[model samples]
Target: MTREVSRTRLNMLRSYAAHDHRDNFQKAEMV
Candidate 1:
């Protein structure tokens, strides 16, 4: 159960990281 929770949290973190990276790319492109 703990492992499953950790996995879910890790996935959420990865998604946020990806979103931030994409945002950064977009800002760079805009500039």
Candidate 2:
């Protein structure tokens, strides 16, 4: 159970990072 929870959390972090990266890329393009 603990392992599953950790895996889920890792996936969430990875997705969040990807989203943040995309946002930065968009802003860079606008500039």
Candidate 3:
């Protein structure tokens, strides 16, 4: 159970990182 929770948290962090990266790319393009 703990492992599953950790896996889910890791996935969420990865998705958040990906989203931030996409936002940064958009900002760079706009500039």
The TM-scores, one per candidate, come to 0.93, 0.95, 0.95
Best by TM-score: 2
Which TM-score value belongs to model 3?
A: 0.95
Kindly list the per-residue Cα lDDT of model 2 for residues 1-31, writing each as its tens digit: 9999999999999999999999999999999
lDDT against the true structure, each candidate:
1.00, 1.00, 1.00
Q: How well is each residue in 1-31 modelled by candidate 1, as lDDT tens digits? A: 9999999999999999999999999999999
Please count the clashing residue pairs in each candidate, in the order shown.
0, 0, 0
> Can you give the lDDT of residue 1 in candidate 3?
100
Q: Each candidate's root-mean-square deviation in Å? A: 0.4, 0.3, 0.3
**Superposition TM-score, candidate 1 onto the true structure:** 0.93
lDDT score for candidate 3 against the true structure? 1.00
lDDT score of model 1? 1.00
